[model samples]
Target: MANASSAATLSICSSSSSSFFSHIPTRVPSQFSFNHQKPKCRLLTIRAAVYTAPSPTPMPAASSSGIVLVDKSDSDKVNRLKSVYLEKIVPILKEEFGYNNIHEVPGIEKIVVNCGMGDAEQNSKGLEATIKDLSLITGQRPVKTRAKKSIASFKLREGTTVGIAVTLRGNVMYSFLDRLINLGFPRTRDFQGVNPNSFDGHGNYSIGMRDQSVFPEIRYEALGKTRGMDVCITTSANTDNEAQRLLALLGMPFKEGAGPTVLLRRKRKKAHHFDSKIKGKK
Candidate 1:
């Protein structure tokens, strides 16, 4: 009876031990694995983030392009006034209409330079001489131009401010432009092309000429002497935007696709820009 009881107790303990071992996790020497029976709960948190980049800058328009801008110095209105148009208008007319040709557009007000001398009493004798000199060159009297002095400008310096402009048709503007460029600008050693944004919104430009002879680069030998000019071209009074439109129509190289509205910059200025002419020590 004692042996039977002992045997029964041993069997019961062995079975319980086996069941506990089965419920506990077991590891193999070589590797281990998970059952993964439960559904994944982390999928709801995943999301895609949207991102974007900026656009590129466009180039300048063409029509408003011209020469260097000179600082206006203190001088009388007449001395301050220099019209590049006076120098080239005839040529433009000739180029478009063929020699001595003038294009007549009745609606647009013709640009005329004014000396605002008020009355003869205000017009000094010196003014008379200047007017006579002007008369000899331009057949028309020095009528007042519709443009006013730049308000921010301190004062109109005599022989300082020069007016530059372009008044030619697509075809004529082209022909005269060839002549002016060929005669005016030298082949700058690394010349690319002229800036399209030289003009204001009103399609006008006034830049300084180094000298009359800086142009006339027809032959290498002819540079020493040539009749050069300083001038400006102005448009019929309108908004700056419309002026840009007119210049684009005339073939000014606006950096942007169609025409010049604002001025264009060739190379961008960098944060660490340096001038070749100056010592970069500082």
Candidate 2:
């Protein structure tokens, strides 16, 4: 009986141990479990792209004398009036004036083109048109001329734009002069010659054009209104005689019998007539 009882106790203990082992979960190995296993990484090979720049075209080499021999097609041609002045006018003036040196011969210093707009403050479009026309006439850009002081009579305020002007020098001056002489004057109506009395006492000449349409650059149909312009030619000449002579040689057409001597005589006669009237009144 004792042997049988001990055997029964051993069987019960074995059954309980087997049931506890079944309730506890078994763990998978770290190498084979998806949750703990690391994935194999593969190395990728990439190739870099190479770029090459094209070579530049060779430029014409300069000569030993420091002169670059450029093709005529590639270079800007010289101005015709400038060439004439250098080759022809200079030598003629030197002989005619009996100048001691070539530098002593009077030449044009600059040209000032002015267009006054009394109603610029009121007519903004006119002012803009004037600026555009002036710019077209002169190759250079036009600058606004502002009123220096307020004028009650004219209703002009200080710093208000009253006019536009352009000062041309160098090659541009020569080109403008050439065009004015060759094209502008010839296009004017009933034009015999320019006024001989328009020279200032200080070797400068002024020309007033009644119509801006005289210039070929201006389109008559496009104009909002007709405008006038004043052209003042400044020269290096010491006296009016020298300046007038210079201009005459350069194809400036002066009125017949309107020389400096004739103008001087007319001035003297006017002065004498005024003196006679004063004496008679006394």
CA RMSD per model (angstroms): 28.7, 18.0
Model 2 agreement with the true structure over 125-232: per-residue lDDT tens digits: 888888999888888889999999999997878999889999999999988887898789999999999987788777899999888888889888898788889999
lDDT by residue (tens digit), candidate 1, 86-201? 33232443353343424431112333223333233344554454444333333334433223544446444343323222234433333334344444445333344445456565
Instruction: Evaluate all candidate structures by whole-model CA lDDT and list the values in order.
Output: 0.41, 0.82
Clashing pairs in 2: none
Candidate 1 wrong stretches, greater than 4 Å:
1-178, 181-189, 207-219, 225-229, 256-282
lDDT of 1 at 40: 64
Model 2 misses residue 164 by how many Å? 0.4
Worst 10 residues of 2 by lDDT: 60-69
